[model samples]
Structure formats: structure tokens, C-alpha cells
Target chain A: MSQDLVFGLYIFALATFVGYQVISRVPPLLHTPLMSGTNAISGISLVASLVVAGEHHDRFAAVLGFIAVTAASINVVGGFMITDRMLRMFNKKKAPALAKAGS
Target chain B: MRESLINLAYLVASVLFILCLRGLSSPEQGRRGILLGELGMLIAVVATLFKAEIVSFEWIIAGAILGSLIGTAISLKIPMTQMPERIALSHAFGGLATSLVGIAEFHRMRDMADAAATVVAVAASEHALNRLTMGSLGFEVFLGSLTFTGSLMAFGKLQGFITGAPVTWKGQNVMNFAAFAGVIGLLVYQVIFLTAAPQWMFFTMCAVGFSLGVLAVLPIGGADMPVVISLLNSYAGLAACATGFALRSNILIISGALDGSSGLLLSILMSKAMNRSFANVLFGAFGTGGGAAAALPVGQAAKGYNEATVEDAAAVLTASQSVIVVPGYGMAVSQAQHAVRDLATALEKRGTEVKYAIHPVAGRMPGHMNVLLAEANISYDALFDLEMINDDFARTDAVIVVGANDVVNPGAKTDAASPIFGMPVFNVEQARSVIVLKRSMNTGFSGVDNELFYMPNTMMVLGDAKKTLISLFGAVKGDGH
Candidate 1:
């Protein structure tokens, strides 16, 4: 019922709206790059959640914070693993005969 | 409620997550990034479990156990070849869960208000109206719904349940434009209607969201999977962000925003790699194989380059000091990257210097060959890009063309009448000798006979890529005779 709470909620709503609009217009071709790039941002969220939870001495707040941290962490970990795997595919060695046979 | 502990935990977790993401940007440190992310999650989960009011511990436990089991099963069963599809499917699940959570929360609030009014016997419905006033819930519902459906469609396409080509009519762009307009119109209408009476508008919006997801992915082809995958990733992130807003969670918003932006950047890089615009990739009819001009007959080419057996190829390779391997879409189709890797290892043991020459557009997708090679666990330093290895061909004792055609075809650069005239190709002919391994003298995806096949220095090794590579590997290792 507080004015500050209402203002905070409104700001979040605005962010959601703006974020949705921008994301929807994104060309499908830019998906991977965008995903990889935003992956870092997701990291920021994890940090924010952690900080919030640590500050809240209340048991409920702490628990919620932990959950957020866990989920975000999963996203970050899996994302990097997959990205690294993808990049390595680009530099695979060829059979040696290819060099010898061509000569 | 003490806030200091919560803030501190949030800060540490966020810092770790950021560091993890930054590490993932490069191929070398990507694994570290994953570990950091895992650490962040562990911290978040432990922190959240400390909450006091969460009475449904049983449900959370059950959900966590089930989820972990499923995740483990998927990771163990799915091959690296199907990793992209798995990621897409995961995105869909994430979006769906977020949407369901928003719906549940919204309904709970509505029911609570209704119950309070009934118990008090109040004539005013103002409390119930106020409960439904949160715009964050609606936004979450919309974005989550869209991401869920869109990601599913993408998964289906990648899995080959749907055609990979751009599904469009003559005026498809106009239709897409109109559909988008209609979605916006309905969204506005729903918002206005929600202010008064909750009608079928909510369901209608969900339907529109689902349709938008389908429409967004329907135009992309199999060849442009990297871009599509990245875009879907962004949708999932944005959906998460929406969920955060609905829940008034700052962590969610920040993480979601990060995911959304990275997905955008990845798509851009992938598009640039293909030398195409994002718009062109989206609207263009891709994966139309066999549309190129018919290839010239094998017999019509210069007589010296007629097909030879694997034994002959082995002889030349064994006698040669240096070999250059050129791979193409055929190698990918036959899944012969491992065989090629094996053959390379064998040759290297024989004191033969082997180097792989990769063309920019060798396989169906960008980095297709690289992915295959990586799966074979070949060393990174051994693979050479076209520019890096082209000049060295002249000194090569033999050039082994494995399932490669268009990329190494001399006609692409020298022959004016060639359909792929301007496309850059490997200068394989510059090598002192050339050996091509193929099932037949068929042309490539571009549908043109490779003139390099008939060049004086070239000899065709006719057979399946996998079988031929295996035989060649055996032959090279058999006494080096």
C-alpha cells in the first residue's frame, strides 16, 4: 500500500514491457550471439539476488534469494559449457593423409 | 525481517555469475564459466531454502529431485550432435514454467480477494479489482507464453518435425507484418478490457502469443540454426525478466536482461559469419539443395583424373612427405570426422606432415565441419583456415580431398562460366598431387562438377567417406609400403 512499493512495481512493469518489445523485434538470425552476450547479464542478476538475500536476515528472504541464485547459476554454467563446446568445433584437426596425399 | 544477510548473499552470487558469464565468451575459458555459474546456483538455492514462510517443503523437494533426475538423464543420453536441440528444448521448458508460475500467482491473488469479500459480506468489489491491477503479471503471462511456444516450434524444426525451409507465400512478409499488427491490437484491447471486466481477452492473448512464436521460427532453415537457436535463447531470458517483474524480484530482471542481450549479440555474430543480413536470413528461402546448375559429366573432363581405388591413394600418401586434407559437406553427411581424425593420427605417426584446410562455407552450416572435428577430439592447432594453409599447398606432396567438392573446386575462381564463379575455393590444384575420396563423382550442394577432380595432379578415390577413410588409414599404417 506504500507509495514507494507502487512506484517500484511500476518501474518493473515498464522494464518488462520495454524488454519484451525489443526482444520480439530481434531477427531470428541473431539468436545465438544475443544469447551468449546476455548470458553475462544473467550473471549480474545472480549477484543481485545473492546480495539481496544476504542483506535480508529474515529466513524467508534468505531462502528465496538462494533459489534465485541457484537458478541463475544453472543458466550461466550450462551456457558457457555449451558455448565453449561450440567454439572448439571450429578448430578440429584434419587427417594427416590429407596433407600428404595432396602433395 | 532482517535484510542485511539477504543483500550480502545476493551480492556475492551476482558477482560470481557475472564473472562466469564473462569467462564463457571465449572458447578457451568457457568451461570455467560453467563452473562459476554452478557455484552461483548452489549459493542461490542454499540461500533461498533458509526462507521461513515457504511451507510447501515437500513439493519443492519433490520438484527438485525430479528435475535433477531428468537433467541428469538428458545430459547422459544426449549426444553432442544433438546439443543445440537440447538447449532449445530447455528454453521452452523454462518459458513454460515461468508462464505457469505467473498464472498461478495471478489466480491466487484473485481468489484471495474474492474470499475476503465473501467472508466480510462487502458490497464493494474494489479489493478484488485492486488485486488484479498488477501489470507485471500480465506482461509475464504474455512474454512467457510467447517464449514457450516459440521455443517449441524451434525445437520441432531443428528436430526435423517441421520443414527447415522458409515457409512463406509470395506476400508472406506483408502477412507477417499484419499478424504482428493484429497481435499488438489484441494486446491493447486486452489491457483495456482487463480494466473493466475480464473477458476471453486473456485466452486470446495467450493464443496470439503462441501464434507469434510459431510465426517467428517458421521462416528459418536448417542451415541458419545457429541464429535461430540464439534468438530463442533471448526469448527465454526476456521471459525470465518478465517473471522477475511480476514477482517484484530484482535478481530475475537483471539476469533476464543479461540473457536477452547476449542472445542478440550471438545472432549478430553468426549472421556476420555467413556474410548475410539478419533480415535476409529470416526472409530468404534457404536450404534449397540441388537447385544449382547441373554438373559436367565425369568422363568429359581431362582423362588423367579418372577414379582410383583406396589402395592407390594409400600408396601415394605413404610415399608422400606432406598431405593436405580438404573436407566438405559430404564428410558431414557421412559423419566421417572421426574417421578423418583417425587417418590423420595414423599418417602423423608415419612421419607424414598432415594439415587440414577448411573453406569458409564447406558444410551445410557455418562451423559445421569444425563441430564434427571437435567431436573427434582433434587438436586445435592442426586445423588450418583456408587463408592460412592455401599457400602451403604447392609444397604439399599430396592433397587429400575428402567428401569435399565445391570448396576446393578450381572453377569457382578460374572458370568464368561456373555458377559458383565468385565464391572463394581452396587452391588444392596448386598442390603437386591431389587425391579425392568420394562415393561417386557427384557434384556438391552447389550442384556443379568440381573441375579439380579432373586436374592432372588429381586422382579420385571412389567409396564412402567413412569406409574410404578407414581403408586409407589401414593402408597407410600397413608397413608404409
Candidate 2:
């Protein structure tokens, strides 16, 4: 493989390992929030989409990039907001602190 | 300098996202986790605007504003019960976006190839329909197109727009596999031939991929929705990763890998928790009672069970010193968590300790029951997982199984011939006195009859969970100490 391909694969492999380690420890009750949180993280693509749409000044590329930016933005904003809402409810309970104490 | 700045900012954003996952897994740290995730997204979005080529911002700004407004409205208005469907819809959008960009990029590159045909370096270069890029595009479009339809199918099933049961027909699996294989076949052909292949071939692959997505999910019963959701989640991440490859974007690659791997892990963990294989979950055509082992003779259904009145169930509850409530999808369907909570409160006032027994696959999604209970303001301490609280069932005075069937079904443990056999289930039958609140003697999604219902210690309170629990609440409170 070429140098750039090797670099990309290395990043991909290491990221997967890190992700697996991080998520394995999560409590089941946090599954929903974890999902939504990651949903927001996936929205990171909105940035590249914005650059692709604006950087080239090409008509069609701009259109595709705009739509991608829109979709990713929705995922980011709605995902994080809903997660925040759910996490708020979870935090409202004194039970979280107490439950973890026993574990 | 500019490229390095962008890369550095992306690195920072990646770190924040990592922290988000780390903190999000714990209930107590959930809020900070979301905050970090949001901050990371903000930094990444802002940094992207500084890329040297972006001369115009009108369309970008417009799209963001419109998307944000719609997204905010959805987040604000969607009921928490519908969150899973909402998530499925989000997956659909993300998948669509990625595929659209991939197609656009390929078409643009093809146009360049045509324009530069006379330039020997351009025409003869590996990039004359670059094999690496085409391979990634093939991977990206195949997954993205399928994930788009699969998630929409899931949303339809969850939202009541489609038949909630497993939709299986003759040779559905064979057909699904064929469709998927066709997409892969075309994708491979496209990779080998690059732009030499006709453009219609790629779009045709997308068409078949879409159909494959729908058929793949149709055979899956609604009961296994948690697995399906997480599996689709993994698919969405893989699609994103493939797009990252096609685009050569660092943030997309890192975050997509993170999302993809975590989703797969969650799916595997859920499958393990339920004591089923991923293959079993995918092709088992599970949750349809029509499976081979569940051939209950017509009119023989009521022979093994007896129903009890609300007072008899209440008397058992009133006499109990400790009660463990095991909830399932029926509670969510009937919206009985609040009534159940009221019943628990009344039971507690009567000097009984009440805790919930949450089987990992209790509802349509993992942690679905927790979300319902939390929405009703039930204390988190009152909820206990199967592992943490399964042993407590034997010593408890009573288990008020609220509309839960499969999770509490003893068949998972006892009947080797049963569809749910070998699947982990709550040992509700082991409790001293089992008080079951269900509408009737219906089998759960696994298509197996619950032997727990027939056990002598079990008392079936046949009615709607909310109505029954509400009455039980009244009956227990009306009986003076």
C-alpha cells in the first residue's frame, strides 16, 4: 500500500480499538445516550462537507456539499440536544450516584 | 501552515469526541459527555469554514439554518417513546447525505477525465478512474444506500406504519441474500473496470442495495428491534467510514470508525446478553410465533393457565413484604409505567420493598425500560438489571410482571425445543408468588408459550396493564392497614 493509504488505515484501526474499549465499559442504562452522543460525533463530517461545498465554487459540488452539510448539521444539533435532554433526566435521579456506589 | 492548522484543529476535535464516549457510558457523567461532544462538533464546524477554498458562504449558511431549525423542532417535539424511530430516521438522513456526496464526486471526476483526455499524464495516470477511490465509493454507496432503506424500514416498524410482526415469506432469506450479492457483484465489477463500466451499473447497484436493505429487515420480528437498531447503527457507522475513505477526510475517518466499532460492540453485547447469536438474530426470523417449536394446537391455549382477579392479585401484593416489578414492551405500548409507579408507591407505603427486574432485552431497545421509568420520575435505584437482581426474585414475596412475556418466559431456560430456548430470561417463576399483569394469555415475540404463566405460584391478572395497575393501586390503598 502507498504511504497515505497506510497512514489512513493505521488511524482507522487505532480508532476502532479505542472506540471498542471506551464503549465496552458503559452501563446498559446509558445505551440510549451513548447512541445519541455518538450520533453527534458522526456529525463531524458536516465540517468537511461545508469546505467541499464552498471551496470549489463549483455549482453541482456546492449543491451536494450543501445538502450534506444540512443533513449532518441536523444530526449534530438534534442528536446532542436530545441527548442532553435525556441526560438531564438521568441526572435528576439521586439513584445514579447510589447505584454506581454499589457496583 | 493552513493545512497544518486544520489538521491540528481536527486532532483536538477528535480528542473531545473520545472524551465524549468515555463519559457518556456512565449515567452520572452523561451531561458532561454531551457537552464535550457538542463542543467538539462546534470546533470542527468552525475550523472547516476556514479552509482556503471557501469563497462563498450563502448556501452553506442557508442549509445550516434550515437544517438546525428542523432538527431542533424534531428534538423538541418527538416523544421519548418515539426516540428509537427518530434515531432510525436520523440514520436514513446521514446515509443519504453520504451517498449523494459520493455520487456527486464520482460524476465530477468523470467530467474531469473527459476534459483532460488529451493530457497524457491525466489520461494515463492511476487516477484516470482511480481504483482506490472507486473501491471506496463502491463500498460507501453499497452500505449507504442499504442503510438508508433499512433504517427507514426499522422506523416504519417501530412507528406502527408497517406490520409490527416479522414479515416473512417463502425464500425471503434467499432473495435478500441474492439482492445483497447482486449489489456486491456490481460493486466488484465497478471496482475492476473503474469508469470503463457504464454509469447505470452503479445506480442499479444502489437500487438492488436498497431492496436488499428492506428485505433484510422484513424477516426480523419487532421483538428483536433492539438488536436490529444497534445493528443498523453499526451499518450507519461503516457507511460513514467508507465515505471518509472516498473523501480522504480525517475527522470523518476517525469519528466514523469510532461510531462503527462502538455500534458493532453494542450489537454483539446485546446479542450475548440475550443469549442469542448474531446469525440467530439476523436470519432466525425471530419473534414470529409460527416457528417450528411453537405449534400450540388450536383451542388448547387456555388449558394450561388460570386467571385471577385484581383483588386476588392485590391480596398477594398486600401480603408480600417485597415486590419486584418486571416490565416489558407491553408496558410501553399501554403507557402503564406511571400507573405501575403508582402501584409501586402504594406497595411501598404498605411496607413492601419494590424494585424493577430489567432483563437486558426487555423492550424494543436496550435501556428502553429505563427511559420509560425515568420519564415517569421513578427512582433509578428501584431499577435492577437481570444480573444484579435476578437472584433477588427467589426471596421476594411477589413479582408483579407488568405486561412482560418473553423476558419472564421460563421456556428460555426450560424447553429445549422452544424458540427462545438458550436465551437468557428472568426467573420470574422462581419467585414465591408471581402476579402477572397482561391482557390475555398471549405468547411473546419469540412465539413460545410461557410456562411461567402456568406455574401454580403465578397469578395472571388479565387486563390492560395501566387499567389493571391503576385498579391494583386503588385496591391496595383502599384496604386499610
Candidate 3:
């Protein structure tokens, strides 16, 4: 009923459509990397976690917030790093092949 | 001004994330796309640190540093063959963080409301935590808690720490349904009927969520893991989206939607590849009694198959001018990817053109085979999907099936009564000669007997796939000498 909630719902619906359009085009070759990449991006929850950990509202909340921050940062850091490592392997055979195909 | 800057940063980050996914459509732009995502994450984190509400920095700094160290170690040390397990574990972490944030938010809001009631009118208590926020928080905790345990179960199965067979018992589906209903009932009660938040109800929902996760995934066989992993990825994303509603952060909502849709699409694709609907995979207990019962039929039919040695297989390869290799989860189980690549190289040296035919649902997750092959230093250009290379099988002189069975079975196309009858499979039978490298005559995870193994032109080389491939490679290389 609130204006902000209404706007959030709108964003959620539209972003989902955008996501479908973008993800459907991704080939099966990079699917593993795509999953990990989106996973790392979803760690955007780290933004919320930082506020909870740093707000100093209460000791109990802060402790929970600390763990939340740590867990989310792992996804952010590990997911992206592993994805990059996988993509690097793919690039090895792609560079020359893609060059010839493009020309 | 400060709020505007943070919102602007989130908007920019959303665009970057979208572009990053677009970049993933090809192998050439994949790494650069990941770099864009990393930059977006950095920008979002920096802007959050400048928020006006945050009063302290020590805990945030400490958690981030420790997490980065552990994450880095894991990324650097894990082998590509273990990618499915690693991705499942990462989903668990994502779920854990989302649920913990929801719990903290709920606790803070209750305390703030209590504190406000003493200074202002009694009605002012509701202002701190409204009905909408309560609903989204409940939604967040439910999905986040379930995804946490579900992913861990998937990880355990993939890592071989737990049995990969479908574990079922009497009335398993009924019990799962009850637990799922309980969570929804609790969520509906607290969010809609009560003015005050009850701690017991919320935590009870959390417990039920965890139980539902374990029960739901318990009956799914190892072969159905690609769908399970993708579905969990979707749950983790939806949890984050609900968290965004609780916190009113647009970036969280946008990224969560992207992640959620990506998982949903992949699950659909994976399910289609196996010719099974989502409901069948979730509740059919697909390979439960079928595996043991199916083994008996295979035992009777085994007498008709032709078993060959490495020398015969090497001779077959030597005569062929073109070869296609089909890989499956068996390859991953035996860790034979490097050996596969070596054999292909030897075949290539003798003027045999070798290419890989990758099924969409091969291995434990989507794109599982591609990553393993890439790690083995095989050119991505040599790998073809079912659509690209299915027709080429007829023209090829030989087809080598390494640790793969069901994907190439002719039963999928010819037998209507077969469980996997509608699934698309490679036409290995159409090739001039077929060489199958398997450890034993055991049926695949689906528990179906493969007719391809009994075909006259098909030669079954029984042994450890890696050892067989190594021997075959040696024979081919020796011919050159």
C-alpha cells in the first residue's frame, strides 16, 4: 500500500524481464561462468550487511551483522574470482579462433 | 545529497550488472564481463560505507578482510572438476548472509518500536516496523533458510561425502508437503493477523524452512543435480530480493531479480535436456527402485554385447579420418578429462579430426563439461552442442564415448516405453564405428539399459576410463613412431 513498496514491486518486475532477455542469449559454453557471475553480483546484499554491522544499534544485532557481512563477502570475492579463473581457461582457445571467425 | 549519491551508484551498478551478463553470451568477452561486475561491486560497497546511519567501522572491516582471505584461498585451490560442489557451497553462503540480515533487521525493528512507545504515543510504535516490512522480512527468512540447507545437501552429494542415490522412504512426499504447509501457515499468521511480532513464530518458520529444504532434495537422484543446483540459485536470489523490500535498496532487488531469472531459465533448460518436467524431477523419485530393478535386465542383456581391448580400439581409431568424443558425468567421477584430451591429441597427430559433443545437462551442473574441457586446455572451438554437431555424427568415421552412456543411447529415440524416450541424444549409432570406454557394464545414474552398447558396430572397452584412454593414447602415439 505504501508508495515506496509499490515502486519496489515495479522495479522487481521490470528487472526480472530484463534479466530473462539478457540471460537467455548466453550460450551453454559460458553457463557455468554466468551462474557464478550472477551469484557474485547477488552478493549486493553485502551493501545491506555493511549497514547492519556498522550501525552500532545493539551488540546482538552487530554480531549477527558481522557474520552476515562475512558470508556475503565470501560470495562476492570467491564467486567472482572463481568465475574469472574459469573464463580465463576459455579465453585461451577463444582468442585466435574468434579472430579468424570474425574476419 | 548523500542519499542521492548512493542511489546513483546503485543505478550505475545495475546497468553494469546487465551489461556483464550480456558479455557472458560468448567466450571471447566472458573475462572482460566479469571485470565489469567486479568494478560494480566495488562501487556499491564504497558507497554503502558512506551511509549516514553507520556509526562504527571495525566489525565491517574485520569481516570483509577475513572473508576475502578465505574466499581467495578457496578460489585458488579448488580444481575445475569440483566446480559443481564449489558453486553449491557458494549458494549456501549467499543464503546464510541473507537470512542473518533478515534476523538482524527484525530484531532491530522490534527494539526500536519498544523504545519509541515510551517517548511518544502508543500508535507511534507501528511506525518503526510496518506491516509491509514484516511481510517481506518473513519472506526473506523463509527462502534464505531453506536455500542454505538445500545447497549444503547438494554440495555434500556432489563431493561424495553423502550418497548420490535418491534417498526415499514411505510417505516422503506427504511429510514434505506438511512441512511446507507449516512454514506458510506460520508466515501468514504473523504477517497478516498479529500487530506485534512473535519471536517464536518467526524462528519456527525458520526451522520448518530448513527441514523442507532437506526433505525436498532428499529424493532427487544424483542425475537431477543440475536442476536442483539451479533451483537453489533461484531461491538464494529471491531471498535477496525480499531483503531488498525489507531494506528498500534498489540494487539488491535488481541484482536479485537477475540472479533469480538466470536460475529459473537454466533449470528449465536442464529439465528439458532430460525430457523430464520439474515436477517429475522433484517428486518422481526417478531412479529409486528403478536402478536395482533395471540392473537385472542389463545382466541378462550383457551376453549379446561385444567387448574389445585397447588394441582393437586403437586400430579402429587409426582407420578413421574423423572422430567425435561424447563425455558424461562418468568422466568427472573418474577424473579422466586430462586423459581424454591427451587421447584426442594423439588421434589428431595421426590426422584424425577430433571434436567433442557436449550434452546440455552433462555432468553435475549446467556447462559442467565445458569448464572441465577448458581446464584440460581443449579449444572451445572444438566443442559443439547437440544442435551444432548432432548431424555431423553420421559423417564421422568413429565416435568415442568416454565414461558416458545414457546421452548416446538409441533408446531415447526409438523406444516409447523408455523413461528417457523423449530426450535428445547423440546419433553415435549412425557413425561407422563406436568405441565406448566405461568402467563396467553398470547402467548410468538413470538406471536405464543402453542399447547402443549392444549394437554390432559398438565396441565396449571395459576398465577405468582414464587408464583405458592412457593406453589407447600410447598405442596411437606408438603407431607414429
Candidate 4:
């Protein structure tokens, strides 16, 4: 394998292990948030799309890149915000009666 | 210097993503995790802008702004009940983006190779697209395309636009397998021949892949959606990993691997919760399969189960010292979570200890029941899992099962003929009195008759769960004696 391919493989393999271990430790109650959180992680591709769309490429390539940038940007921005909104619902209730009940 | 700075920034972003995932392991740190992830994304996007390859920013800025607005609107507009559908739609978008990027990269490099070969010498730069790039890009496009269509199907089912039941015709599996094999054959050819492969070949392969995705998911029943959605999520992650290989981006490699594997883990967990194998969940005929293990005897009238008046249920609840409320998809269908919550609060007023029994696969998605209840403003502390509260059921005064069927069915534990035989169920039968609120004697998602309703300790209260709960609340209030 080429050096670049080998390097990428090494990163991919280790990160897969980390992902499994991290996700497995999460409680069942948080699965939805875990899903949306990782959804945002996949949005990292938005960075590459931005570069591809901005560069002086052929028109066809540029159009493709523009769509990718828009789609990925939506995934990142929407994914994080939605996840944040959901996670807030997971917070402990702060109702005054429940608060003094000594949870 | 600029290159080094970009690499360093990517490295930092990758580290933040790892930390962000770790934070998501607990609910307390979940908000911080999202913020940290946001910061990581911002850093990566800003660093890419400084790479010196970019000549113009107009398209990038315009697309980013427009996309963010739409995304924000979607996230805000979708209700908690519709979260699964919305997530499936987002996965489709992610897969589409990855597939498009792969196609663009392939074409750009192929054109460059063609130009150089014509100007310089025979086969000079024609082979510039190396074997590894060719293979990875081919793999990326295939997975991305499949995920795109598969997730759209999932979205359709969850949104009620399509029938949630598995649509199996004769030779369904055979057709899906053949189409997918064709996509593989084309990918292998492209991988071996590299740039010598025809451009149309790759595009044709992508089209086949999209078809295979739709076929693969169509036969999966709604009961098995958690697994299918999780699998689609994993596919999107794998496509992203391939994209990382194509782009030589470290962040993509790291984050994609994480996203892909985490999705796989969830699928496995979901399958186990349902007490079924991945093959059983994916390929088994499921609800319509001939292996149906319903415990109900044919031609037997409802002889064993007793119909109870709302007053009898009210009497039991008002006098009970300890109660456990089990809410299921029926609760979701009636939008009765708020009513369930109100009932709990009223019971609590009488010093009745009320808690919830949440099965892992209770609603549509994993942790779905929790989200619905959480939206009802129920305190998280009052909820308990099967293991945590199962033992306490026998000593409990009353267990109110609202709109739940199979999860509480004792047949899973005792009936060897049951399709859900090995599935762990809520031990509601062990409680002193079991009050099941049902619209009728209909089976649950598993399409199996619940034996719990007939048990001597159980009483079936018929009607829509929301209306029943409201009536029972009145009865409880007036039961002054």
C-alpha cells in the first residue's frame, strides 16, 4: 500500500476502536443524543467541501463541490443544533417541588 | 508554513472530536460535548479556508449560509416525536454529499490524466489515478449512494408516507442480492483497471448501488426499523471514511471511523434488546413470517381475560402504596404522555410511590420512550430500567400498563413456541395487580397475542389510553372513601 493509504488506514482503524468504546459506555437513555452527536462528527467533511468549492476547478467539479459544501454544512450546523436541543431535554428537572425532594 | 499550520489545526480538531464523543457518554456532559464538537467543526472549516488552493469564496459562503438556514429550520421545526424521521433524512443528505464529492474527484483526476497523456507521451500520466485511490473512491461512491436511498426509504416509513410493514414480494431477497453483486463487480473492475475503466462504468455502478439500497431496506418491517436505521447510519459513516481516504484528510478519517463504528454498535445493541440476531432482524420475514409464535389458541374466545370497569382500576390505584407505570407505543399513538405524567403527579400527591419501567426498545428508536417522557416534563429520577425495577414488581401494589403489549407479555418468558421466546420482558405479571389499558385485545408490533392480559392478577381496561387515563383521574379524585 502507498504511505498515504497506510496512514489513513491506521487512523481509521484506531478511531473505529475509540468510537466503539466511547459509544458502548454511554447509557441507553442517551442513545438518541449519541446518534445526533456522531451525526455532527460526520459533518467534518464540510471542511473539504468548502475547499473544493472555493478552488478554481472545472465548472462541473465546482458545481458538485458547491452541492457537497451546502449539504455537509447543513449536516454539521443542523446536526449540532438539534443534538444540543435534544440534550437539553435530558437534563434533570428543576421544578421547585422536585428540587427539594432530594433526588 | 501554511501547510504545517493546516495539518496542526486538523490534528487539534481530531482531538476535540474524540473528547467530544467521550463527553457524550454521560447525559450530564452532553451539552458541553455538542459545544466542543461545534468548536471543532469551526476550527476545521476556518483552517481549510487558509489552504491557499481556494481562489474564490463566493460559492462557498453562499452555499454555507443557505445550507445553515435550512438546517436550522429543520432542526427547530421537527418535534421530538418525529426525531427518528428527521435523523434519517439528514443521513440521506450526508450520504448524497459524500457520493457527489467522490464522483467529482474521479472525473477531475481522469480529465487531468487524459490531458497530460495527450500532450506528453503514451500512457504518461494516464495512470495517475492509482489503484488505491480508484478502489477507495469506488467503495465510497457505492456506500454513499446506497445510504442515500436506504435512508430515504427509512424516512418515508417513519413519516407515514409509506407503509411501515415489510413489502416482500416473491424473490425479494434474490433481487436485492443480484443488484448489489452487480455494483460490486463494477467496483472491482474499476479498482483493477484504474483510469483505464470507462467513466460511464462508475456512474452506472452508482445507480445500481442506489437501487440496491432501496431494495435492501424495503423488506425490513417497521418493528425492525431501529436496526435498519442504525445500519444506514453506519453506512453513511463508512462512506465518509472512504471520502477521507480519497481526500487524504486526517479529520475525515478519524471522525468517519468513529461515526461508522458507533452506528454499528447501536445496531448490535438494538438487535440484542429485541432478542433477535442481525440476520433475523434484517432478513427474517419477521411479523409475517410463518414462524409466528403467537400463544393464542385458534377459535378460542376471550375466555381467560377479565374486562374491568374504570371504577375498579380507580379503586386499585387510589388504595395502592406503590405503583409502576409502563408506557408503550400505544401511549405515543394517543399522544398520552402528558396524561401519564399528570396521573403520576396525582398519585404522588397521595404519597403513592410511582416510577416508570422503560424497556430498551420501547418506542420507535433506542431511548425513544425516554425522549417522549422527557418531553412530558417527567422527572428523570422516576424512571427505571427493566433490571433496576423488575425485582420490585412482585411486592408492588399495582402496575399500570398503558398501551404496551408484548413487552409486558409473560408468554415471552414461558412459551417455548413464542417467536419472542428469549426476549426479556417487563415482569408486570409478578406485581400484585396488573391493570393493562388497551383499545382492544390487539397484538403489539410483534404480532403476538399477549398472555399477560389473561393472567389472574391482570385486568384489561378497554379504550384509547388518553381518554381512559382522564376518566380514571376523575374516579381517583372522587374515591374519597
Q: Largest lDDT belongs to which candidate?
A: 3
* Sort by DockQ, top down from the best: 4, 3, 2, 1
Best by TM-score: 3
Return the TM-score for candidate 2, rounded to 2 decimals. Answer: 0.94
- Model 2 segments beyond 4 Å from truth? A55-60, A91-103, B118-125, B289-294, B297-299
Each prediction's whole-model lDDT (CA): 0.62, 0.80, 0.89, 0.84
Residue B274 miss distance in model 3 (angstroms):
0.8
Q: Which ranges in model 1 have alpha carbons more than 4 Å from their true place?
A: A1-103, B1-4, B25-29, B51-53, B105-143, B190-194, B197-199, B289-308, B319-321, B324-333, B357-371, B384-463, B479-481
The residue-by-residue lDDT of candidate 4 on B66-179, one tens digit each, is: 889989999999888787887898889889888888888888778878887779844655346777778888888899999999999999987778777777889988877788
Instruction: Give lDDT tens digits, candidate 3, residues A1-103.
Output: 8987999999999999999999999999999998999999999899999999999999999998999999999999999999999999984453333344235
Query: Predicted candidate 3: interface RMSD?
Result: 3.3
Give the Å shift of residue B26 in candidate 4: 2.0
Q: TM-score, each model?
A: 0.72, 0.94, 0.96, 0.94
Superposition error at B246 for model 3 (Å): 0.8
Please compute DockQ, using alpha carbons, for every candidate against the native two-chain complex: 0.12, 0.46, 0.56, 0.65
Residue pairs clashing, model 3: none
Q: Return the clash pairs for model 2, or none.
A: A55-B53, B287-B445
Docking class of 2: acceptable
lDDT of 3: 0.89
